[model samples]
Target: MPSSLARCVLSCALSAAALAIPVMSAQSAAAEVVPMPPHEKTFASPDGPTFVVGSEGESINKVPPLNASGTVREVFISGSSYTRSDAPSGGTLAVGYHVGCAVELQGGNVGVGPNAYLNPGLLDQEDIGPVVSINVGPGSVSDVPLLTKEVVSGVPARIMMRDIHLVVNGCIGPAVVRQYTLMQLHTDSLDDIGVVYGDPLWI
Candidate 1:
């Protein structure tokens, strides 16, 4: 073959090889790891001490069930809570996730006071831990606590959960979840409650 024809054939072969290789774009690379934004809340009191709670975490959703009947997720959460009170009775902080399937969780009410569901004595021993497994159906929600520990006066209490497995079943639709950090402080005069809620995750 002529020299010019040979060069053209070489160039065409190089172009074909380049087209066969796969390339990943920046957005596609970023979509692999989703990070939840950090959230925090502070509660102020006139007669008692002020309190604060914060949460930051991430979740990885496994391949969706082929039938869309359920979902499996791996979640990581870190929570920080503290109080300025020096109450003789002390205080406690709990951190966890609230998972819902086909249900709206935003603006949901969190009851306070003695009869509230989040009251110190209301949560059973089986509900608090570093690892938890939850299953909920449509229109229902579940709170899974990853950590619950005492908070000392003027000291910060930090808690974390790493790659904990969360499985949801019997869902007609998708699953959405969020992180919650609850703190209850017992003062000389009254009880103070502080709560922090993270952004929602749809998996």
Candidate 2:
């Protein structure tokens, strides 16, 4: 049998070891539960525009909005106007016209044209696309290549139409167009919209 002094030391040592067991187990469990960060990449369009897409962040499935300012390089009618008569008696006629324009940034990059479509029903939907706010200036339609003072001042403009599709004519082949919107409000910057996790732990 051990002496009382030795027995007391042994008992204390065992108690300390027992206390340490729970702490070590807790740390191990925490390590196992924590998830790893996601991968990311930056994508650019042929017209010298760029955006980020990745497994993380608010714009995971959708393209974020872009802010660009530059001089107008070219403006032309990319599509023909559609005309429809109200009745056989040659009543009022409705016309739908399409236009195309490009802007040359002060830094020499080009903003091809602004085009976009809106789906009001998709407001609460998920995994569809990003929502963006667009702003244009007065006389924007007529003031191509020559930006008005309002536009230069960055005044939020309005969108006259939605679900717009403009067909470009006389290109090497069917060209890819980047769509954007024009409105009065601005969207939050990319940095302000932080990363978002969307996958299972095992993934």
Tens-place lDDT per residue, model 2, 40-128, is 43433333323332331111111111221221111111111111111111111111221222311111111223444443222221222
Query: Global CA lDDT of candidate 1, please?
Result: 0.57
Please give, for residues 29-50, the per-residue lDDT of candidate 1 as tens digits: 3233456777777777667566
Q: Give the TM-score (vs. native) of candidate 1.
A: 0.60
**All candidates: CA RMSD in angstroms?**
10.5, 24.0
Q: CA lDDT of each candidate?
A: 0.57, 0.25
**For every model shown, what is its TM-score relative to the native structure?**
0.60, 0.22
Which structure among the candidates has the greatest TM-score? 1
In model 1, the number of clashes is 0
Clashing pairs in 1: none
Error of 2 at 197 (Å): 10
Q: Which ten residues in a row have the lowest lDDT in candidate 1?
A: 105-114
